[model samples]
Target: MQIQSGFLVFLVFYTLITLVLLHAVYRTSQLIVDEEFHLRQGEHFCRGRFHVWDPKITTFPGLYLISASLLGPFKACSVYALRLTSAIASIVNAYFIFIIRRTVVGKQEDARVLLESISLAILPPLYFFSHLYYTDVLSVTMVLMMIYFSLKEKHNYGALLAFFAIMMRQTNIVWVGYILGWRALDLAMKLCLPNENHQYRLRDLLTTVQTLLGSRFMFVRVIKLIFSSYYGYILNILAFMAFLYWNGSIVVGDKSAHVAAIHLPQIFYFTLFFATFSGSELLTLLPRVLRLVRNRWYITAFGMALFAWIVQQNTIVHPYLLADNRHYTFYVWNRFFGRWWFARYLPVPIYYGIVVSLAFLLFAQHNGRPPLIVSSLVWIVATVASVALQQLIEVRYFILPFLVLRLVQPNVRPSRKLVAFEVAFNLTVNVVTFYIFFTKEFYWSDYREPQRLIW
Candidate 1:
């Protein structure tokens, strides 16, 4: 309890500081473009209409449910008040972040890693997402919740959290992979088994081949079970029977080709998955490299893979970079790509420091490195390649790396050399990005605008 109390104290102090900074951004006229986007959808949901037809509101109703239940009619509040829920949710999320790190790094025994990770997460670029209505906050919030309950050495609370997070945002379906692995371990008693109910429906699932095959077959049925992580599988199976489940498409009219145009970016995303997941094939060969290079094998592979993967994903490798947001194009976006880091007080450098440090951490450490390290490396490389995939500098792409942190056995807080490298890399890129955003075609005109005009 004393440890929990200490964590809460530090978390509160950190959140209070973040809130002060974010408030300035909110008060400004130049707030994020998507800041009001979700709130508007909540407003629509509060009006009693299904949100499917509207492109922006097309996501699952979980977020809108909160909007309706908590805030009621969105029009009742001004835009800022409507957005207030997201900012608050962001703060609430930090508590979970701190708790998860404490649970993992502290071994439920220490607080240093918890404190350090919280400190790292609070850095500017990450901190900025908390204030905006962007789904990053909601998505990450759910992801962390999943990590927390799943990692409770004696409790299955983390798995339950994963379900809720997945429901709140479908994109987090990627996390289902982690939870499944955890469940496999739990079922076999291969790892720690919880003493408690661990917070899931404990009822026996009676599945018959006949029932499963009558309507759904093959991977379709397998994925329907996976979808149950978001929607109850039993219920989803029932829904599938009723709706006539089809693999990629059910409707004969078929608009996917056109939808593909709008989502041209996902091509990069899907390819990223291919590159990352398939890279594991090489890990099978790592023993050979390790025999030759020993501990340095980690560094060599990290450098070689990082470079080769980047080259493979770049526009010169493909051609998508020739399109919109061209310079930053491939899969992911770095503030360095568009060169906009410093326009706001948010520290871009700190953000990159976290990324590179994580990349090296997963790549450099081979001691506890096994499936987790391997997966983390795949995630980091592909997601970095995602910068070339997505035209925008969406920091949310780092979700895999963030979640991968949960599986790692704690290390002593990174060494000074490692920490300094991260800090230096982060700050340098941040300053460069700051310079770019401040002077760019977009930010300079807005920079000189009066604070009143900003409102």
Candidate 2:
């Protein structure tokens, strides 16, 4: 009864918010370049440019096709129409969030799961993007659906949704691959180990490989199992390659400018965001953390200062404040480290060391490693590593993985104080960010002229 009531309330609340966002975003005069470009591509597709490719475009045709299908019927190219799609996608995403919560926390804790769904629905990062017409919401919605089906033990449906997600955003291949990889790992472990109680070790691996190879039939069976489990991933990879080939380049947009490169600080940035988002949950563990850091407060302080200094030196400048080099990104990269290669790249090793150490500690704290828990950790680490390999550093890139990780997290049964804090913090941040989106201007600085926008 409580679950039903909470769901009803959330439905009404989310619907009202979506309607307001759709109305406001459609009427706004200001346009972000990313959305504008996507809109144009949609228009072009509607006008029979299906076979044509644009080198300037940085993504697949999934979103363009979606928008064209919606707008072409009415002969509308309005920003509102694009955002209407996003609004609808977001609602569907909320439903998936609810289902995911129920799956992770079980039906017995209906109220808790409902609250978790609300937290997901109100997540500021996703909320901000849902107001725009970009593929972010649509893609994330598809990804979430994939996760839902996977958790329900429906791999066929998950694979289908994953294919669609890849179409929505090519980068989704990494996410889909992560899921499939975990499944493959789980299957391999099951096949190689004689019993569920077997502990995996170097010697055990050697013995298993030798035993399997000694029997040709068993080796053949192992090969068959491997292929059968991962056929979907193989198909997706082939599709991705075909799309890239048809697009006439392995990557879209400015490849030289945005080629794959290791940026170790990405893990740090995303981990910090996740920690902040659930700061209340983490506060419970603060005593232990503090105890670990006791007598090392000065070292911790120095490390934070060093991190701040490094950020100051390598911040990517935002276009709106380019003229004034006082902005955080500008101050860090331009004023401090732009001219010195040594200073610019000096933090890479330190970040790697810290992130790796923390990740191992996190895994160690889990005690018994169930397949589900181990797979989840692997997925999180792989997702973070994927972003770390990217040339660009965008907060949006981290949003889906963060949400997914949170969704799969164990039920904490947070105290009333913690729940209240989370609710208040989410509400405050959402309201402030929403107001800023409508009232303020930020700029995309990659172009020669730079474009004015709000995000």
Candidate 3:
């Protein structure tokens, strides 16, 4: 009966998310310029053609390759086809979440599942991402896969999954490389020596490096290279693309390269990176944030999110603040925070962030798990580190790490009474947010548009 109830709740939450995302994809189909590109790619990719050079004459072959690969049965890239792809990715993502919650947290967490339910169900930023169409949907799903499979001790499969994710979108190149390479080396060492913790010997490391740079081994070699030297992988991508453009088959437009290249003062960069990227040096903030969660954390988090939103307006013009492609999390938070001005005045993003943080911090403080010690620290530092990029919010970066605390940390299940209380309080927040967002403009319209306008 208990299992049945949990499964039922999960399905209900899943159903709600599906419905909301469908609405979002349909609504979003009309808004974003990127969606049009994705839609066109879905349409064009079905024909088995690859574009290397011209968007007018050729498209970005990468994402389209993904779409085409999925086109085994679909006829063309209509709204249904593109959205279907998005839907499939969402289901896969949700399934990954279910898997994590079930295995990582559920099995052991008699009390922890309460926290999981609250975090998964009511976290506004993550919830918002579910309804939208962006590379993040896929990137995050792959990230969960990487984490889950790696933890499950399926190193090769996990590495392969991480590889696929990086291929789909380049954002994870650094994180995935670090994670997969470390694990692979660890495993190789274990395999090489039956005892005494030996693997990936000195010679193995040299050979692996040679194999990647030399490309003698090909697929495996490239994988090793991607992990060994990620920047080089990105450069190889740019060089190959440049090669096509040089040969005249493709025309790469825009001053994005120029834009990304124009340097800001290192002082400003340092400040931005420091504030955004949390390191061991910054663990001081965690306790502060945790303390805030005891009472005023939601209000403080909301205010900070608003500030991030406000600053992000300038982030666009000065890519130094945020890369053009990044910063959606802040943007979304700004939007959700702005919803306070909607028909009834609500703070969807802020309210959720606050409550979620409260639950997470309080649970960690109360439970006191040993294994979670390092994971929690890593997540905190990384989440803070995420802000340094400044261009796009890409909420998944922080949210993913934030989520680890709930999953890996110990769970002393709150009482049925407390769980019921949290569930109710959180549901109220969600209800209010849905009402506000349904009636209002995009999430960050209030803070963002004004900033964008004033600047």
Instruction: Specify the highest-TM-score model's number.
Output: 2
Candidate 3 lDDT tens digits, 1-84: 475467567766766666765675465334342454555555666666555233432222445566677774556555655555
lDDT of 2 by residue, 147-207 (tens): 8888887877888888989888878887787777767655655676768564444445556
Flag regions of model 1 displaced more than 4 Å.
1-6, 51-53, 56-58, 73-76, 107-111, 153-160, 185-393, 406-409, 416-455
lDDT of 2 at 196: 55
Candidate 2 residue runs with Cα over 4 Å from true position: 46-54, 74-76, 197-219, 241-250, 295-373, 441-455
TM-score of 3: 0.56
Q: How far is candidate 2 from the true structure (C-alpha RMSD, Å)?
A: 5.2
**What lDDT is reached at residue 349 by model 3?**
43
RMSD of 3: 10.8
For residue 303, model 1's alpha carbon misses the true position, in angstroms, by 8.1
Ranking by lDDT: 2, 3, 1
- The lDDT leader among the candidates is 2
Cα-based TM-score, every candidate: 0.58, 0.79, 0.56
